[model samples]
Structure formats: C-alpha cells, structure tokens
Target: MKSEETPFEGGPMDGRSLPVLVGPTGNPPKTYRIPVPDDAGGPPTVLVYRRVPRAHSKRLGLPKGWKYEFDPEGKRGGGPRWPWSKPDPAPDATPGGKPDDTHG
Candidate 1:
C-alpha cells in the first residue's frame, strides 16, 4: 500500500508530480494511465505514460530511481497472457521490408 511521488515528463502531465502506488516489488507499474475527461462530455481519453529511470548509479550504472515519460501513441494494453496459453501467431511478412527485420 506504499506510494512514491513520481514525476512525469512531457504531454499534459508535464511538470506535475503525483503519488503513484508501488507494487510489492517496490517499483511503479510499467505504464501509468490517466483518464482525462472530455470538455464536450464524451468518453474520457486515457493518457499513457511509461516508466523510465530518473538517474543511474555512477559505479554500476544501474537505475537509482524512476520517472514517467509520455507515450504519444498510447497503444492499448493487452490482457494477461499466461504461460500455459497459446502464443501469438507470426506475421506472414515484414511490412517494412528492412534487411535486419526478423519477420522478413
């Protein structure tokens, strides 16, 4: 039930610090979602923010703290996929057609 005052960067939440609930692992969720009510009273738009390292250790170069950065795409999160469930099927071809593309 602990929370951390996490700072968010970019987007509508820029320069704002909000208390984010931390999990049992003592880290914030990978994605932070904020629901913004529409002015016209339509469905609320959820803004997605992704967690990132705020600073790194000098000696080991490991993450010291965490912060949130705006995700412009705001892709929809998928439901939980258990290990026993079937894996996602592979794409037929690579759309980008890049040489380094694994699905090419």
Candidate 2:
C-alpha cells in the first residue's frame, strides 16, 4: 500500500502509454506521455492522472474530463485552465449563458 509500490500484487503491472500536455494556469503547456495501464494493479492510483479543460485539451490534442460541456470547443484562442482555476465568463457568451466549469 506504499505510495511507491506498484498496486499489482501478483505480477508485473501491465500498462499502456499515451502522450499528453500538462500545465497549471498561467504556465505554458508541457507535453507528456501518460500510460493507461491495464487493470492489473490491485487498486488505481491517482499519481499520474490530472484533468484539463476542453479548450486546453483541444489546444493540446487531449480529451475532456468526466463532465460533458455543451461547447466542446473551448474559448477562442484560450487554452484549457487548471482544474482548480476559478471559472471565468466566456468572452462571447451572453450574460447568463456561461461555459461549463469543469476540468477535462
């Protein structure tokens, strides 16, 4: 159960890898390759996975998070924000119609 120990108890954990881009709000995006390994580990670890906004995803060629937003495309030119980043009003949306606030 140690953080560093692989969750898989019986054998070497099987895993697959994919590349992704990473960043915190205001920081430039950094590309990374993530492994979506097989369910061999005893339990899932939150070590490697983090969520980004759709705008960021599209800008960086990534996918959305759990919540589905009406506008898959992010704000024009604005990339995704950090999950914890405060929600902001869409540049073009009306006063009441706002963008969904969820990290992809």
The Cα RMSD in angstroms, rounded to one decimal, for candidate 2 relative to the true structure is: 17.9
Give candidate 2 misplaced runs (Cα > 4 Å). 1-80, 98-104
Which pairs of residues clash in candidate 1, taking residues 3 or more apart in a chain or in different chains?
Answer: none
Tens digits of lDDT, candidate 2, 1-104: 11111111111222422222223433223221123444886544322222234343647765443211222222233467889987776668866676676886
lDDT of each residue in 38-69, candidate 1, tens digit only:
99999999999999999999999999989999
Whole-model alpha-carbon lDDT for candidate 2: 0.34
Give the TM-score of each candidate: 0.73, 0.16
